[model samples]
Target chain A: MPHERVIRHGRVEPDAWRFVGLDEGEDLQALPHGAIVVPLAVWKARRDALLARLEPLGVWLEPHDEPGEIAADLPRLALVAVRFPKFTDGRGYSTASLLRRRYRYAGELRAFGDIGRDQLFYLARVGFDSYRLPEHRDPEAALAAFGDFSLRYQGSVDDPVPLFRKRAAVEVRHG
Target chain B: MYRYDEHDRKIIAERVAQFRDQTRRFLAGELSEDEFRPLRLQNGLYIQRHAPMYRIAVPYGVLGSRQLRKLAAITRRYDRSYGHFTTRHNLQLNWPRLEDIPDILAELAEVEMHSVQTSGNDVRNITTDHFAGIAADEIADPRPYAEIVRQWASFHPEFAYLPRKFKIAVNASAEDRTVLKLHDIGLELRRNDAGELGFRVHAGGGMGRTPILAEVIRDFVPWRHVLTYCESILRVYNRYGRRDNIWKARIKILVKTLGVEEFRARVEEDWAELQDSQNVITDAEYARVAAHFAPPAYEPPSDDDQAFAYAVASDRAFARWVGRNVHAHKRPGYAAVTLSLKRAGTPPGDITADEMDLVADLADRYGFGEVRVTHEQNLVLPDVRERDLHDLWQRIRGARLATPTVGLVGDIISCPGGDLCSLANAKTLPIAEALLQRFEDLDYQHDVGELDLNISGCMNSCGHHHVGHIGILGVDKNGSEWYQVTIGGRQGREAALGHVIGPSFAAAQMPEVVEKLIATYLEHRVDAERFVDTVERIGIAPFKTRVYGAGKELARAA
Candidate 1:
């Protein structure tokens, strides 16, 4: 199995996990314990069914909602999954922020779907901890996205301090 | 104008350092062009046709003398010694090296300013009427609310990267100087029966390849929920707004696809969840922000200004200026003066270094040490005492800033088209000069009664030619200059795009074509009907018949 990063809420740690994609009406009962992936539409439609099934196996399911929908389920779930859907659909970004700040969901937040190298930094800021890109994409490229910018103009998940507070610290150090 | 408190100052300073580090990383090649693109854009730095253009935010079009001087110094030090004031109440410097931008931003930060969110797909500088605090018809000063929105939208994590650029404009006056209908989100401040301030929210209005007039989404959203509600709208747009096609990327397209009713439903649904969260403004926070923009210590002055009247009567030039430049202020003895840049031969909104410094000094002496930049591309003194009009006129005249033609034919709004902007197809300044030459009579212009003559280099409509009463759009015909004339466009409360009269005219014949149209309007108009009202009444048929007839006649004669 390839190396995997396990994210439960805002924290990241290494874990031995395998990919388990779910199809519509597929019995998730056969899935391995821990965490599993599901489509956003299917998850929304059968949330109760999947929750009931997963409760017995000690597995948590990550429902990838479109970015704006994440705020609706705020303060309830411990872990929410966001999907890139496509390389460009930025809905996941707003979803992650809504989940983190608006809902105050402190559980694991994982990013799956069309996650790739270019979007790692932004995903991190919006409160995504573990990234699950496609098998073909280079993990190094995705990891490099984390260090693209040394500074950010606004506050985000990666740093709770607003840009102003960060700048004041720098000013004091230099002044 | 909103004074910066410690929180505001700290925010701007932090943004500067963040941009500086981004610039450093970009230079070090740690960040590729694709990676650094949005980051730099959020800081208001754009690599345009020639060099990087830095757009500095002037919230609600208000600036102090100190800020203006700082801008002047920045231009002198780093840029090409000039800056262009945009329709969104921001200033743009066309040529600045990439490495020098951080220094420029740092200088801007010194004056409590930043270019944050001025560009990119994020929320842009929140704009309001240039006459926000001073307009006579204003219900309340819109800047405080505008400043509040500015803080809420600034560096917002969720809406930072939308499908396309977002613009929000607030209009507090009956006369919509901010052109509320042409923005992505327009908030009109109105009072209910209880005299509580609320906003009539209009959504999805924009101009580009696809121009759209906004639809009323909410009749009354309480002023306190302004930030939370706006966040909800932006959140919806960010998630569902189209990103597949660049042309179809704006919230306007999403609003159009979903329809206003469905869009409003989704927004209301989103707001229902977020309203009680931290996004909602607390009463204490509201008072804190509002206090920064509280009205300055204004003492009631004697209304009797016999001296100014005497001065104006004594000097013919001064009288023309006072008649044209002076505007009714909200205060009893105060007047707002517009220093026109529409001199006959100069570029429409181009102010030289000397002129800028001179204006800065005038702002310090005559006004309350503050200056404003209008969307119409003019400078304003928001609080000039009626008693000081004559002395102010003399100072402005000495600097050649007294153009005595605000809202006249000479007060044309021309884009820096083909000469500067790479997107432009034809030259706009020459046509503006031609119009100025033809209409030398101030008495004739004042009689013409408030015509907006706008010229754009191309259909990109940066000059907002679509909404000009007499719109001139530049077109390229067989590699030579050609112009298209449109009539009936207006940008006020009843905003409407102009209709093209007929075939395009050659460069030489533009003055004659415009003159004929004006003459037609003068002849056909019912008593006191402005150009727009006349065109609305008579339709574009008569003007088309006259202009096309003249075009045909000129062609045959040629």
Candidate 2:
């Protein structure tokens, strides 16, 4: 048998968690542990009430408005899903960097919406742990984009020290 | 010149390696034409009308003798023994082979230069007043800020692919010699009432396809926020600029569509979020960069020669040359001289390898081992001492570079049109040659006085035909080349786009048309008025009626 789906807050049925946003009367507060996703507006409006209940059970938040705002709640927020809105909109990348650096939030940062194979390396550089591929895209091909460049010119979250610093350190050691 | 730091050197080396791999993959068929197109473009290699053309970046048009020698060596090795200096202060090699591009890039990297970001839908070579540090009229040197912008925009992950290519020009000079209004982002450095240096910013100006003048977006942006604010504007453009049509993809189209007020508001909104970011330049960093561009140590010479004045008064030919060619310098005993490349029967902006070596040698001997490539497609020795003017003039005359037509009609701005560029509709060089031959009389040219005649092979406006006081555009009618003339376009501080005078004339009739236009200007102008001022005063009606009607009649009779 498949693993048992855990539902919280008594408002949602375990079987109906996969497609919560489609229904008008769906109770987002009682979303199942693994599959449910919430819109940014709903999460922002009832964030306090949702955090009160969701903190104990450890729930994932999809499309969080302020990743920095909810960073203190990272122990419970298993995965923070960021939205791209458009491929060229780079605010989410900055938001992710801030979440990782300032808050030291180690939970998975998943990027979705218009995320293409070409933008993967940059996403990785800014601290995105995983990506929700756009529908109809091959995940294996998209995975290859993460390592397109073997070397980087600048320092980033993934590599806190720049290439020059590292090279100089190595040179000093050998010299 | 800003010497490459370790980081800068490493970045260029890595970028060269990246391009080498990309080229190898392209040769091995691992990358398709479409896949490799943007990569090659970002590396400044373009598949032009005939072969691949590689534009090497010469940041802010200041080059030392060593860098120039590298360019000369590159020309001799990878391309023909010639290169074209573009209006954006970069150099273009016409005949670079595709397979040997990697080796060429390696050579460029060795000299602290590369073709990166020279062409593409990315931040192109950031240009500033060519006479930045050396110009007497300048309030501040603009190269440090230009270099800062270059570093910030180079291979920027977010802005690498924008709506279209972006150009930024900074001018700190009183006269706006860099044609700031023709750039996408025109910055004028100004000091506030409190004596704080800041920038007055303009946005959305461009020339290709739909020509539009830039509109002032900010009265004064503080110097600290220059990089972050510019990045914010680029971010807004990258997100919202049209991508559907290639022609309408430039920021000018968006500015036109949203109106300048709305565009300014959008940029402000973006800047508000980025104002306090890490990208904001600090005072220390600003000082560090500025220190790199501080003026060279100069001891004031005691010898003041009135020889040039006496020579000019004595010799009419030399006087005419001085009147047209010599520009005042800020230093007491120096002047900047423009060696006109638009000599009769020579292709505009084409200087042979031998000429380049000679100019390089002259720069070492006379002018501080530094040379500048001007936007008007001429070579400038910015620090020629007044005392050495005669000796330098003799040497330049021997090399046939003393054309004595700096701002005259014979100093025509012509593009490498159908002969080189793929986008041209008609041949521009031959037409330029014809006009130059007709206007060869030095006395007649000086009498005409400060006429800007620009020619572009097409409406892409690389030759900046729209802003020329006397503009000539090459057009194709049936199977033959035709020329369209316009009047009163000026690209200086009081920038204005030229207006089309009338119908197109055949190639053979181009010289006659130019003659009639000049004659009309002379007849109708108030005393000492320029071609632009005369056209502005009387309008194109009197000039057009005379040139197109009675002037054509006179030509027919002759």
Which structure among the candidates has the greatest lDDT?
A: 1
Best candidate, TM-score: 1
Query: Over the stretch B31-126, how does candidate 1's per-residue lDDT look in tens digits?
Result: 668768888888888777688778889887889989999988888988878788776778888888999988888898888888988988889999
User: RMSD of model 1, in Å?
Assistant: 5.3
Runs in model 1 deviating more than 4 A are: A4-38, A41-80, A85-88, A97-106, A112-127, A132-175, B303-305, B441-443, B475-482, B506-508, B550-558
Q: How many backbone clashes does candidate 1 have?
A: 4
Query: Candidate 1 falls in which docking quality class?
Result: acceptable
| Model 1 per-residue lDDT tens digits across residues A1-175 | 3356543333344544444444456664464555444445545666676576543211123323443444554344444566555644567787777767656677667777665555666788878777666666556545645654555544455665544344456656988
**How accurate locally is residue B357 in candidate 2, as Cα lDDT from 0 to 100?**
82
lDDT of 1 at B156: 72
When candidate 1 is compared with the true two-chain complex, its DockQ is 0.24
TM-score (chain B) of candidate 2:
0.96
lDDT of 2 by residue, B233-338 (tens): 7766765678778899888888889998889998897688665565666565566568787766555865656887788788776766677777787787777788
Q: DockQ: which candidate is best?
A: 1
